[model samples]
Target: MHDAGDAVSLLRDGVVLLGFGLVFVLLFRRLGLGATLGYLVAGAVVGPHVLGLVGDAESKIGVAELGITLLLFIVGLELNPSRLWRMKQEIFGLGLLQVVLCGIAISAVVLFATHSSVAAALALGLPLALSSTAQVLPMLQSAGRMRTPFGERAFSILLFQDLSIVPLITIVAVMSRNPADANGPPGWLLFIYTVLAVGGLIVAGRFILRPLFRIIGNMGEREMFVFAGLFTVIASAAIMEALGLSTALGAFVAGVMLADSPYRHELEADVEPFRSILLGLFFLAIGMMLDLHAIAERPLFVAGMALALIATKALIIFGIGMAFRMPWRGALALGLLLSQGGEFGFVLFAQAQNALLIKPEAASLFGAIITLSMATTPFLMTITRRIRAQPVDSSDREGPVADGANALIVGYGRFGQTVAQMLIAQGIPVTLIDTDIEMIDVASGFGAKVYYGDGTRLDLLRQAGAAEAELIMFCTDGDQLSAELIDGVHESFPKAAIFVRAFDRRSLLKLKDAHVDGVVREVMESAVKMARLAMKSIGIDDSEINRSEEHYRARDKERLKAQYETGDLRAARDRIITQDARPDTGLGGGGK
Candidate 1:
């Protein structure tokens, strides 16, 4: 039986994670590295194999799994099926070929070096077939590359990796020692099982989960909702495992099915904390699994192998990216981002150990190598940033210029595209300024007068016709830049009507304070539609509903002003939404 002191020690273990996490975050910031790398390095320090600060906890694996689940779930939320179909050439065509070529090439090299069977070589190769979706996406998002062409290409590749894992793992499972590896489950039987599991999941995910969630939501219990989220993951995983498939694959499929659900955001919000904690725990467990004692004794061998792994993978990716017509800097970033082995490699290695396909010592060595590779990513990204910031040739800046039209759209992102296309269809003269080179090319192909330039710079805006323009629309995501553009426009072109898209009420208030003529709330538009629907259902005339909505909108403006002054508009927004739902609430009664 465990002693009371053991219980106390266990209680203290959680505290150590907090202390280590903070020091790591601060030190990484001081070192000019991102906080994510710090968190990973901190896990290494606190792991049982390192400083012995905290021993491995099996429950932490669940935490890490949760992290991956939430990470992929959020990714699914961002993806639009229509957008994916449009990018199928790069995603399926280019991406599929890259995975096949890379996997085969890497497997051959690894098999030759290790004298491993084809199964073992293929298992090892599969890990490198995937790039780090988590690392790449966040880096692109931070560098404002998420809206760029390179970003879209990277996303397509990442999506392919996500989908490929299912087939790759299935192959691995088949190749690895089943009691009858020569005569495994019949192909037809396996196919039928996979089909049935996937179909049932889709049916349940669509019809059953929605009604279940709606019932739970009506109960208004936050904890219950969180429980339901967990239930979904566990239940899906169980069904998949019963059919001899991966739990990760099951979780991913469940997420894809729920991607269009209204409750997705709520589900994500509810699950994120659990996911983060688990992923951290997963990293910590990885740290504990590393054989640091062996590394200390064989530092030269470990270092050499790490260098070779990184160098070879980098060269392959860089070469392929260049061949695909990626600009030098973009190729450099892609190569660096993918140079390392990922957590998935560790997962595959562990499975190989269970199958007795790889020696335990060999698995340990591979695991350490995989961990080291993941740890090196942030360092590489930091270096890549420096490379990107280097001076470029003037001749390389060749691109078509935006026409000096009466109206200028300073951004060509999703929201900007919608507004721009509508205006163009009406024959209103418009020019677009966007920093994304790919977006500029795409928009120009569709007959838009678009140029690549940093819109935040007033000089660029002036050159793009902001001064002579009848109107300037700010539809970008950058809060500070959008606000700055509004201020800049007021100073330079006081006669031009400045319209800006607001991410939320706070931003709208900020724009209003800047005396902007028009501000569109992203969520407010959706909320108004919902309000109109509810009112119509309750026997309110369409004309009266429109008037009521307008009155509420005016009331909301005043309320937002007060809330903004108080600097707690989130709470105020909630209150306002609640009040808007009540018939007796004192905003207004009828049509405009």
Candidate 2:
């Protein structure tokens, strides 16, 4: 039923979009830049302003909007009520200050530079206040910092920004409304309507969605569950749109409603592909909308504005981190990680333009600035990391005096703390070494004799009396670092019995290769304990369970030793299974 020209246009758009998108992504990835930036460049290259290969930017915008909706939905899914409650300080305090301060600062700058009205400056500044969650979060995860103090704080602030979108969108809509319409409904009446609409949606979600999903899930068709989830989002978005509320806000509420459901992860898995593709399309559309001609005309001015915005955001974030008593290094890292403008800026600018809050030209210019800021994020974070890694003054390195302690502990984290506590309970004098100064200071407050230094440093280890210590234990969460430490210590202090806390089987093997005196897998003992419980629950006698556990442990140790010596885990595992399957031996029967 579609026109032949329209069909041709669709085909051409898909081919160009995918073709350019793939090449740019590969190239950007190779350069250590992210895929989001790659997609943006692809869109710009194929857009009418450049090659004129794709002129359907207007048509693509609707599809791109779906991406934002799904993104908000996923954000909602992540933010269960309990998590928000737990992170209230960072979300409300740090997040609020970041937005308000950044907004005011950027607004003043815009007003001074462009001589724009207060409302226009504010419209520009508020969206610029946000940092890119989609970009920064993945970068943090890849760097293995998500469990660190800095990462937790960063996540909390980003979460608050995502939640703020609901009110921000509402404010923009109210501002965009005509004065003539304002005369029709009193402000109090509108407030009541908004409250009632939100309450009604929550109620519907609690009652209607749970039962609907249960039924769909019972049917056991994965596609049906996906369909139902999409239906819920679209339907809720429609209702909110009709009620003069933000569709994203509505979709978010729907996601939270199902957050406690058993199918939450399933729903997330089902919707992820759609969310990712749509979000990419959204970024691509923004890319297509870039006014490259404007940039060419005033390159210095545009670049200056972008740099100014990043500087403002970084300063404000650093100030907030300092106010919260974070170390200077941590504050600097936080500032650098979140200096970029967010994906939400695109959404806000589009909405603002639609609401007549900003002109098309202003929107175009701001969009370009945000895109550039986002593209610079990876480099900024890398620089911050390098700065953080620089060696500190030796005078700052204070630690517990070795004092001839027989045992030296490296990495006073959760695992190390437990081991240290048990040793201390028996009146054992211990020297603990950790690189995290903050963590060491806190542990010191709890009467722990913790040292602040990189445990892997040979001089630091020597200072901690590693050469004289009877036992040296590596209890850090970092598997590679633990293996490296074991290797170094074994080479330098062969008399010290090195016992390592391996994170998994792979780490255990690595530690074994390092010729450590003992390698205790972090999870193996707990797994064995649980297996004992499982056996008892199935009517096995306690004595039998104990015998079985002992037999299994001995056999596993023998197998591990054989695998280490032969460097053939697969063959060792096959031989063990073959021995266990035989009926004659008591140990083999118990093993099976």
Candidate 3:
């Protein structure tokens, strides 16, 4: 789709790539590795240097790079402006330290190891300082640690690394030995241009995006929203590309502007599929670009530099984490988690090659180093599990895991909001999921985070961390809870207590066979409370009021049990006064 293909060649490439990606991903996942590595291995096997099944990795990468932009946009949605500002210390302090120290140290290593000039070393080394955001984020999410203190810190560092790409590119350009490169804008001018571009994006997002979403949401067309979502991301990225800036950053800034939008989840859901496919393709292209012949010629040099890059970055980052007061275990884990060479290394290396600061052979060699280093991450992190598996204790010897969002609330309407707030007030971590984009927008305006999805689905719940959640509360506004759904959820996540908001006595009776901890009628208690208040307002004595309230509750309970037992509507029909009241429809009050 990146460009028009006239022959069967395009179809052939698609079949080959997707087919191979699917098989390898399944195989690797079954083997306890990861999809990223599988994609890489698949691409390598099919690349020109290997089976020669695919060529033109460069054009593929040009199209696939949109994946990186989309990735950053999603990452941006994870943090609102306030949260991002709060983490300024970590992003700027710890992150800046990590990139600069790792860059300098790796450059020195390259200079000594390769006997390269300072320019060549810097061109190669700085890119190695960056870690793979695409690789690390999913691992953290799958582990249910993406919202933890540790996860936030990791996210902050990655964010800064992304922002640093502009400067790294500028640095490479400044050191260019090619006469052609001399005509490009100088470093300072580029910096000013970057600032102007970012400012322009911020202004546009503030003035343009919300209104556009408002219109799209008003249209109430989900398909239209999908189109709008992609348009937003692509348009922002395109502007950055026009300015020769980080297209990913432009998408990110746009995301931050809408972080608190009620449509955040909808946008995320719409964009995620594209992000995954493109990101996979991006990895595949990186694999195809790897010059195995170049690496095969100097395997020792490539392997040694890979090891050295990982070690230097890991140690430097570990020290920096400790300086930021992270415990040794957390620090060590963080270091290893981010030690891999990033996708941007290829971009920067290409820049280096273009500038004549490094030869094409050098670029290919370092690209292999990055790929090799990336391959080691899953293994290293898998090993770090033992160090972090233990729950933190009073002694503080263990690195604490991400433990927030232990409760998943399935609605955010009026009823669901009260339930969530009460639980949150009690210090329970709650994840709010809703399907109503309008309601989500209102909640977001009040600074509440609500994800968009059909929470009844087991797969969606699992993605939201229902496996570890202590409670699964169904506060949806109707008889949306079914016995089968409840039973499925209970079976799927046995550890979590299940609760549902019953629409009426009939609904409660329907759930008698379901595995649930509790069920409450939507308006039963509030109706009773209103009755008590009405009695008091009419000057009824306290004892009489209490007696009347208890009698009504007792009779209602008795009727409910009788109807549930007999499975007949008439079972409790005679229990209620029929003089003035209409028939009970066995439905909720239809409250918003």
Candidate 4:
């Protein structure tokens, strides 16, 4: 407890965490488990109860709290209201349905099993209604479901859960009956505090933070922008606390208001390093706090509680998914996805313990249960993989009628639009096949010849005259699927020339692997166009133009390869630009 001893204890804690984190990272890589799961496991190992290295586990919870705030800020940056409003039915109706139904069902089960009061049951159930956005979204993106119907449904539910935590906290605070003066404030007062805190933060973010960010953006200083983002988080959290509301709510509100701000993406990119480290520390603190001894001592009781918790929550989520007419497999997937208690559970559980909604022993039991359930979710997902492996059965539309079209555009994305427009201007009859309804709708409004169907769907492609078209363009983005389409088009229509769009170098390699007639890197094409314009501005002429372009492309590809290999993009960019600008360098004999 002495000053020197405290310093040594802190150093030991850091050492414990460093060792634990590295081991978990290696294990996670081998297991193909995500880094977040690895972080949690690392926290558990080095936590106070396991090794006593963290020493007084509760102390670091504050830093973990800040990490959650930063996470919410980043999440807020992802949600733009105009875009959100476009999915109002899903966000409002289905989202609210998922939260309320899940909460009520789980609360009822808990009440019956524990003989707890309705209010106490509600307090426990509210947290279970939330799914882990951090854990789920990245996986969904990796699965290529970010824009899919199922992904949108999952996203809406997660967003609602985040918003609902505010009300849940207030309700628990008001309903608890224990200590004489436990009636901290009136419900109306809490409501007032919540509204003022949220509204004021939004106003500040818009009028103040937005302008400040614009000024900092003009400075073009990455470090300064990072500092400004941190300032926003801390300031919002402080304001929320001052107003007797949750700091998480304030941070989220700040994020939502800045969702459409010009510099939102820039702020996110700059703030990432800080957010990442803080979040890692947070997970480490969580691990260090775990009382594994307690879990072992009451193994049967804790195991029973954890099982009951997951079962109750899963059943509720599954039933809701079914009622929404989600396929059986999708329902099972949804059930498993939300079986664990999320981050908000910690907040509410702590509050409930303080408010005497349950005894300290019960709170400890709940905490252990939450941790166990979370730890098991990844394995549960793996077990249900077979159920999710079934192919989606969307009804196929007859592709564009085999017509007088000589050229065919297979995708209607940014690259496809440019290609289609230019072809149309040149009086080429181009038929478009795209699966996106929104894109098809927009194209229809502009009187563009577009088919509303998946290009990769063989029937649709054949019906669209793939066998007869003079030219076939595989401008779609998926890797294997796009390659399949190219192969199918080539096999079915041997005479048609194939032009494909490559998403990245790997995709370019895949296209080359498939031996597509011509492949263009969609993003690099834009960069090359800009480079050509710059070269022209500098009085570069026809004799040197092709050589200069080729040199830039080769240098750019090398730089990208180096960046990917080393995970140090800034250094690679610097090397590329420095090498390119040198006059002594030969651009393959083009006046270098």
TM-score of 3: 0.64
How far does residue 450 in candidate 1 sit from its true spot (Å)? 6.1
Better of 3 and 4 by TM-score: 4
Please give the CA lDDT of all the candidate structures.
0.71, 0.81, 0.83, 0.74
Model 1 lDDT tens row, 1-592: 4798888886888788768877886786576444545566677788876788887545565456566655555555545577677998888865786677767777776787678888888887666667656556666787776766778777777777766766776777766675644354676787888888888888998899988989988999989988998788778877877766666667777777777777788888887887766666665555566667766776665555566667777777777788888878777777777776665665666667656677656665766665567667778777578785434334644332446677788788888999888988888888777777656667668776667677667777777777778888888875654455578778988767888888876676566557578888766888889989998898878877867777677778778777768756664554354534654544344112
Stretches of candidate 3 above 4 Å error?
1-5, 177-181, 243-249, 260-263, 382-592
Cα lDDT of model 2 by residue, 81-164, tens digit: 788888889889999998889878988988887798777777788889888887888888888778767889999889888888
Ranked by lDDT, the better of candidates 1 and 2 is 2
Clashing residue pairs in all predictions, respectively, total: 4, 0, 1, 4
lDDT of 3 by residue, 149-223 (tens): 789899989988987876787777778888865776776886888788878877777788888888989989999
Ranking by TM-score: 2, 4, 1, 3
TM-score of 1: 0.68
Candidate 4: tens digits of C-alpha lDDT, residues 1-592: 6999989877887777778887896797466455666776788776655655556656776766687788778878878878788888777877798788778877776787678888788877777677666667766787767776678878888887877876777677787675632645666887887887777787787789888988888888888887888888888888887766677777877788888998888878877777777777776665665566666788887777668777876787778788889877787787787777776676677677667786655655666677677767778888879766554334533347788788888899878999998998999888888876546656778887678776776677678887778888878865654456577768877978888887776675444436478878778767878878887888888657787776666777787667656655453654465644554446533335
* TM-score, every prediction: 0.68, 0.82, 0.64, 0.75
The reply for model 1, stretches above 4 Å from the true place, is 1-6, 25-39, 56-83, 178-191, 218-220, 242-244, 319-329, 375-592
The local lDDT score (0 to 100) that residue 551 gets in candidate 4 is 66
RMSD of each: 7.0, 4.5, 13.0, 6.4
For candidate 4, list the clashing residue pairs, or say none.
43-287, 44-287, 47-288, 48-288
